[model samples]
Target: MKYKSQQIAYWFFALCILLFALQITYGFIMGFARIGWDGLHDIIPFNTARAVHTNLLVVWLLSGFMGAAYYIIPEEAQRELVSVKLAFVQFFSLALVGVIAIVGYHFNYWEGRKFLEIPRELDYLVVVNVLLFLGLILTTLFKGKRQTTTAMVLSMGLLFAALLYLPGMIWFDSQVMDSFFRWWVVHLWVEGVWELIMGGILAFLLIKLTGVDREVIEKWLYVIVGLTFLSGVLGTGHHYYYIGVNKIWLVVGGIFSALEPLAFLGMALFAVYMYRKGEKKHPNKLALFWTIGSAIVSFIGAGLLGFAHTLPQTNLYTHGTLVTAMHGHYAFWGAYAMIVLAIISYSVPNMTGRKRFDKTAGHMAFWLSNIGMLGMVVALGVAGVVQVYLERRLKMDFMVAQEETKIHFVVMLLCATLFTVGIVMYMYEFIRYGKPSDEALEPAA
Candidate 1:
């Protein structure tokens, strides 16, 4: 709220909520398909729904991260955004690309890669869109009076993420080579640079909300960056194990991917320790809950659950199974989704001049969404274990195993319903915050 340009973030966050709702709708579609309810199979098949669901999740999070940058960079850099107009242009273009790519999926216009489903032509549009975004952020920082560590780390993360997208766009005839580079985009972003983005945002929030010294918090950020590179870089081997790579990857991946959780562990400890060490006078208790919750839950989801099947021996049986789904849900939710919500919860009130802190609905949204996701993960984990036992161990037919697993989908649907309800309530609260205002720059009395 310090600068009028910061209000641009409101629109991006709005887009984020809209896409997130769409994502949950598609998730419900897939969940129902799993249980033999294929009413929409002809119109929107499972593959289509899955693509929409996962892609929407990624888009929303990216939108949220962009919104976070727009809001944080102005304050951290001690100046207004360089060009608010360009930021809007970037935002709309990004949304347009997402909409086009998502709509195209129904018509089978995609690359067929797991996470890199957007067509190559649309990929170029995405690249242009991100370049515009990074240009606005980085230009503003350099022109400003100061460039804090928080701003630099965040800007660097955004830059690297943009650069990393190129590897996926490369044309490769060999499936193994294609898969190898695909992980450079997918695995490196989540396990690598995205952590830097998350850490930067977390540090900014802690300094503001927890009243911690900047020096103390930024020190932790350095440790996190170091740990992320140390493990996450080599951890790319985990995907190479069965992808026609050399046998050396088996050992490299097993040892390093196992160590990947340490970075997450460091994040959890950093948040908790800072929360305990700092003066907690911030009025936004709900934001505090989200900030703290994201840290702890990420440790469990990304750290512990990821470690569950990280080893070569365990992953051999569990690869491509529902086990991956279980980990994906919690890890993405805890590490990325929850942190996005946390920043939204913190920034919305300040930007919009609405003090809806600690509302019953807000707390309900937090707990319900988290608990529902946990239940869903448990159901998926159980289903994955049963599948590994029936198919991998016993050598049963795949169709038989899938039939047996249909019952678990019922449980998954129920949990998803709960999670959806929570999201609905969160959206409701977001709407209640109303529009941003120029008069809110002054501290609320």
Candidate 2:
């Protein structure tokens, strides 16, 4: 018998909850050190924090994506997964790899690339990506049953994201060439492949949540995918500005990336418009949060703040300041983290066939986490501005100014602590009371 969608989704979301909790823990350590908490540095340093944060995110997202695949593929293909046993093997195998990579990272055995740091198993990531693509595609294509729906289109992006890595990873030397292709794999997955997946999933979700016509949602999905390719590939230039690329790349990159947010903003407007037209209200306000929130936040981070720094002039100073962190805070949480959570809200209940969650708890967690993310993003941006003011414009030495702003770092820590508290409350609620009712949970537009 096929497993219920609720079962698959909820279990996966539970994993996300756990991952977020771990993320906060990692955040705390990094926040402490950033604020001059030297004592904690010895025990858990920058690399350790970066690895934990990035790895945990990958694991949680993979789990959620798998659950999503299992849930939707069957219905779309008009068949069960090709092999539940294979699914288990794939899951366990990937998890095992993740564990080893994380452990290696903790002990300083990494290849030293953000989002590309899975130890020496760069090939393993390739293997896993290919496995996932085949698993989903072959199963979907089995028995001549196919529905090139939004969900399927998104899966294709996932598959290609993996395939792209082959070329993206090829280089003369591992170090120099590795960093070059590393962003191809990393940035492509995040800003490119995953954007498609998130859009598809969110569309699948909105269709279920609000009674918006599937046709409308699918069309919107196509537009999103097109925008992603248009901007994401060339937009990689933004990072290259500092990585020794031509000046023209800087200009082209900023323009494309600036346009990236417009796509998201379109999504937000589209979803909200649909929600308004829908005749009824769904119980999953939180699911809508990520779907819509991702767009708005992307506009702010990728669009506004990105525009702020896109200029060669501004970037000269803001390249590595807290402003960058500010962008990171909102962009990832809003674009990536929120989508995952939104997936949880939409599919988890369906997987379990139960909707017994504490709405108050979920909403509480939602608001708190939102507050925390906002605080962090704003604080980081402000801190960045302060740094630029002192170091770049004033001709002050970086260290001397840093010593002066030690208190400001403390404030950032406090902001992060507050943020962590919010995330914890949200995670706690999800862990304690995010069970679905006695049916599939649906997404809202």
Candidate 3:
């Protein structure tokens, strides 16, 4: 049942890896700047690097999601893609738009909004790119023999994700209004539909790797989706507590945001329960590690740390501090980044017909990257606490407070280097697997 169109995903993944490496490079730039190494300040500057670093994160993750769709949709729908040629076209245009946007950031050609800084002019192009991608995917699903729940859920997530982008694209006169709607995009995506995407992908991986019944696994998906929408939508209010919005948001946002962790808790328990319940012991242990790790870590990172400051009382003090950074980094790593890597680990072997599934290098990549990221999170958390105490509580000057926290960034950089090594090891495994071939599509004996 393997189709040649599935090969298209490999290219998108290649692009993903490229952008991720660039992201880490820029992250290092920002890290060094924090520690007083401002060699690139005149040229790149912290603002520019910050925008590039964050934007690249979004784009690369999207690339991974799209690649996952391209791979999964064909199999789930039980057919070849409606148009592989158009899929390639969408792929190139995506890379083109991402490159243009990154280059523009260096020259100060972007909006100042965090996570949505690609500018209005470029926004149209992004809309078009996403539309083309959606068209291909939906068309394939429509024309296919049967559409499974996993396929539908993944498609729904992708579709809703595209619709949500429009809110951020609109220009608002009031800063309050702009920031309000901006959370609609940022909070809603990471906490809302993105969880749907994560759930669908997680469901697929569990079904394959654990031999769980589809009905049983997908039932958990229903619960996860319910919890996500119930909490995540209203949780948007937490951002509005100090943004000059309605006072009602204080009650609404606090109550619902606190409930958000339940969804992630469900996801973690679901993955572990499914893994332990299944009789099949799939040979891809590394993929299992990532799959299980994603679930557990997301609960801790996104669920626990997020709840740590989500209450109106704590958020007032930690709103724009590095504490937010602490939550953001770990949440994204656990929720989105690890899941994408999990799928890549699972799919790459099947596509390339290489089963280097148990390599020492692969194990190193997982442990090193996770350990390094944990260390980074701790460093950022420590710095954030100090910043909040000095600048917010003690009313010290911001510059002085930052100087007091320089040593933490030094720790962050050391851990970041370890993370870089792990990623390099991952890239090595990817390259060694080589490219997909027609021979890989042959039915197994």
- List the RMSD of every prediction in angstroms: 1.2, 3.5, 1.1
Candidate 3 residue-wise lDDT at 261: 97
Candidate 3, 1-445: lDDT as tens digits: 2887888999888888889999999999999999999999999999999999999999999999999999999988878899999999999999999999999999999998999999888899999999999999999998998888888899999999999999998789999999999998999999999999999999999999999999999888999989999999999889999999889999999999999999999999999999999975899999999999999999999999999999999989999999999999999999999999999999899889999999999999999999999999999999999999999999999999999999999999999999999999998999999998777895633
lDDT digits (tens) for residues 1-445 of candidate 1: 6888889999999999999999999999998888889899899999999999999999999999999999999999988899998998999999999999999999999989998999999999999999999999999999998999999999999999999999999999999999999999999999999988999899999999999999999988999888988999999999998889899999999999999999999999999999999898999999989998999999899989999998999999998889999999999999999999999999999998999988999999999999899999999999999999999999999989999999888998899889988989999999999999887786533
TM-scores of all predicted structures: 0.99, 0.89, 0.99
Q: Tens digits of per-residue lDDT for model 2 on 299-387?
A: 67655666677666678888877777787777777767777777776665555554634476666666777776777777777778888
lDDT of each: 0.93, 0.68, 0.93
In model 1, pairs of residues that clash are none
Which residue segments of model 3 deviate by more than 4 Å? 442-445
* Poorest lDDT segment (10 consecutive residues) of candidate 2: 1-10
Q: How far is 383's C-alpha from truth in model 1 (Å)?
A: 0.9
Clashes of each: 0, 16, 0
- Model 3 weakest lDDT span, ten residues long: 436-445
